[model samples]
Target: MISHTSISTVASIIQLSVAPVFLLAGIAGILNVLAARLARIVDRARSLEMDVPTADAEVQRAEIRELAILDRRMTMCHWAIGLCTFAALLVCVVVMVLFVAVLSALNFAVPVSLLFIGAMVSVTLGLLLFLGEVTIATRWVRVSEQFVLKGKPLYDR
Candidate 1:
């Protein structure tokens, strides 16, 4: 049986954990987006690879350039995912430390604060990496460039 004091402590910990739980939710959302982007990139690369044998020289050259860009963006996205995952893990640690400190009457103020700060920095870096990947994606050849059947050159109509 849990004592009233223990119940109160647990309640307080739950309350404190709310913010980190929300952070975890946001990280999960980021992970979802990164994962979907990665899947699409990989799928496109594989499809292009399959068609390479039959592609004309110009199309093959364009595909090669696109593949290289995709590879770079893929690497950046992977780094973003890793850093965000680390941030989420740190948030989990912060929550656990908060509970432990509260229940044991220990002063973990510095550790908790530092962990939260590190998590924030990690999240920031991860977001920057994601931004870099997305910005580079604009240079990828578009459908307009590929078809180019009835457009006024697309550069200076």
Candidate 2:
């Protein structure tokens, strides 16, 4: 039989775990976005591969360059996803440690704090990698470049 005090302690632990749970949700969302970006990058690379063989030399060169950039973008997105997942795992461990410490009547402050700090650092690095991937995507490829003809507007009046 659990005492009222034990119930209250469990309630307190749940309350303390709420913030980390929210953080996990946010990490999952970021992971989804990163995975989508990676998929798109893969698709684009595949298309470029198919187009390369029949393209003119100049166009093939450009496609190769774009493929290289896409590769970098894919790498960055992969790293971001990995780091965010690790952060989410760390958060889970932190929450578990909190519950274990409370139930076992042990002091786990240092470990929990360290795990939380690691989670923050991992998430921060993941976000930075995401930003880098986005930057490469926007900087290396201009949408208008696709619409232009040989030194002229795609559609002139």
- Global lDDT scores for all candidate models: 0.90, 0.96
Model 2 C-alpha lDDT per residue in residues 52-119, reported as the tens digit of each score: 99999999999999999999999999999999999999999999999999999999999999999999
- Colliding pairs, model 2: none
lDDT per residue for candidate 1 within 24-44, as digits (tens), equals 999999989988988988898
Please state every model's RMSD to the true fold in angstroms: 3.8, 3.4
Off by over 4 Å in 1: 142-157
Candidate 1: worst 10 consecutive residues by lDDT?
Answer: 140-149
Q: How many backbone clashes does candidate 2 have?
A: 0
Clashing residue pairs, backbone N/CA/C < 3 A, model 1: none
Per-residue lDDT value at 24 in model 1: 93
Model 1 alpha-carbon miss at residue 8, Å: 1.6
TM agreement with the true structure for every prediction? 0.86, 0.91
